[model samples]
Target chain A: MSIQISDPMLPELYKVTKIQENTHDTFTLEMVPKNKTKIFSFLPGQFNMIYLFGVGEVPISISGDPSSTDFLVHTIRAVGTVTDAMSKIKEGQTVGIRGPFGSHWPIEKAMGKDVLLIAGGIGLAPLRPVVYYILAHRSKYRKVVLLYGTRSPDDIIYEEEYQNWQENFDITVETTVDNTDSEWQGHVGIVSALISKKDFSPTNMVAIICGPEIMMHFSVQELVRREVTWNDIYISMERNMKCAIGFCGHCQYGAKFICKDGPVFCYSSIQETLKRREI
Target chain B: MKMLKTILENHPSFQELEREHLKFVIDNAENIEFKAEELLFKEGEKADKLYIIQSGKIAIELFTPSRGSITIQTLGLNEIVGWSLTPPYQRSFDARCVEDSQAISIDGKALRIRCEEDSKFGYELLKNFTYTVVQRLQRTRIQLLDIYKIRT
Candidate 1:
């Protein structure tokens, strides 16, 4: 979605329509614009700044299907102040939302090429919309593969959807956990291990990764080792974003304001900055 | 024997070995398979063999008092499964077949003798195994970080 800059800083009122508990610490919130006719639209990878009254706001990626005009969805882990408050919000309550900000996954660029998505933990939240978009336009891509890794079996998000995607769609979904007991009958290892399990034309693929910085670091190393170029790899980066626009510099990484220049960045563009310590 | 040799040649762990060294490995190797849910080796048992997985899955697990067998890693096609190649060599974790699986198992005793007799061959194999060990170590460290945990 384009930046809604007419009132970029102002938050539109949206009401919590439903709240689904996804895991012990994570939850998915579905909100509809309080104004009956207002439409909330976002492209995959864009994030909305969710404002919970009296508690403050946090930037959360839009996790629902982009085609659905009814409500905005965000899958959030209750990590800090605002999100902890957000976790307690019940259905029918009101919250403020601004934007659909930042650049998005380059779905058009991946038209004829294979799309590889690597997500770790809740990092899958931002990439879910991309999967939805791909399933909606299945023929545009070739050999779509998603490699997701989380802490354990219980930590996996969208577990039911994984089954649906595997059974009904043309895409390939491979999941692994960092560790698991015998009760879990799936792969147990880092997400990077799944990269070699599937064959994709590295030179003819677009890889998008969103996860812990270190996990992304190793995954990129593995992809590059497999001959995928940095130019074709994209990563969604998170920083402490205070303002959704470029004006507030709280989320600056080197010379770029993450709020404006990214959330999603081509690895080649930020490779140097990404390697630097404490930017 | 020829098919097994071809499989060894392609395996990442043995791909770098010289022709003679490859022959030595092939001579010491034998085809082995395990049915689903079969135990390959348990922790504290003699680490007498190394397997180059040809098909299916093997889970490297640790038996804990409270949690039962916890799988730390899973090995599949073209992956190496055991590497306890030092003195007092004993399996550090339980290796169990997650499915019907096949592998080329090398007799560790014979392999060790060949390595002791030929320093060059020994170095080559050790180097390859070291690379695999290092990669596993890196992955283990990443897992230990619990990088997925929510940061406050």
Candidate 2:
């Protein structure tokens, strides 16, 4: 059942070992080869183009929490054919795997700085690794704050992880729903409102954001207004990714390939692409 | 009343509304309070009112039995909540009061009647509502693109 595309480097025979449904229409697949437990090491923000036999392939961010390197994980939402196939993939089914590729979170630079992590909807997948890395190296960063927003209480991904993050003493976590829900007991507003209410100084803060482009743009603007310099902010951009290598133009947004050149990038570097609505 | 005035003064849509038209719309609107987790309206229900948040949050939910319910969006204070004039003219979706909330709402039936009585104000209101829906639709399309990749 392995149909090789032109590229030989992209591995097509990885296997799924665990599956956890996160919410309606979304699931996280924990994968490894049925033949072995080991998988390739990846950067904190890298993604792999996952293939599901006849269903085709789509780019997915690695969602393995950094505190423990258990298995390669991807939190996927069933939006199109490829992702729909992904949702049905059960443990023991075979799925394709490609590069643990792309620029990673700058873990070294964030050391001793207050880290602000902002995510919208399912955009938290890309930031999950960064959270893991920070929590793993707990003493390195002074203060960690995670701000997340979703369309509703049901749409929030990683429910258990969210609770753990909320309870962690080393980190301050705030949640917001675009509209509130009966079970949503916290704030009910845009994530930007949470940023506004926090007393964190952006002078010593490094902000990383991923979500809808509009949300990222707005959150970045809010962070800037709070004195977070563009140099200190990082964001993950989403574009169609065909090749994890730069050869495919699908993931191009300006000069970068979100799969290869990024998936994670500094705000100071990608300003030009950020302004273009199409990209 | 002060909260209503301040919210209207601060809202972007009201910024350019003619003073007379603004006052007219405001005078026609009345505040309604809902108990926690109350159903404002259900999908396919008659479109009878348009709402603006005064306080608390409202969740616009879309439900499919197999997949369960997903919150499509949330509307908060100072945000407009429905497009009662839009096609289907019935509620295309469901809105639920997620918390004990207060909202300023105008009767759609009365507004439509008044709009027929005076097309000028109707035109302005409809123009604003259409623009807001278009902007939100564009944002939703992109957000869905980024977040959803269904395997075919």
Using TM-score as the measure, which candidate wins? 1
- Consecutive 10-residue window with the lowest summed lDDT within model 2 chain B: B142-151
- Top-lDDT structure, candidate number: 1
Model 1 whole-model lDDT (C-alpha atoms): 0.89
Give one digit per residue, the lDDT tens place, for model 2 in B1-152: 34665666566665567788677667767778988779888888889788887777787778778655556666666667775765566987778887888987866776676667778877877877777777567545544543322234
TM-score between candidate 2 and the true structure: 0.65
The number of the candidate with the highest DockQ is: 1
State residue B95's C-alpha deviation in candidate 1, in Å: 0.2
Instruction: Kindly report which residue stretches of model 2 are placed more than 4 angstroms away from their true locations once superposed.
Output: A1-8, A35-37, A67-70, A181-183, A277-279, B1-152
CA RMSD of all predictions = 1.8, 8.6
- The number of clashing residue pairs in each candidate reads 0, 17
Please give the DockQ score of every candidate, comma-separated.
Answer: 0.78, 0.08
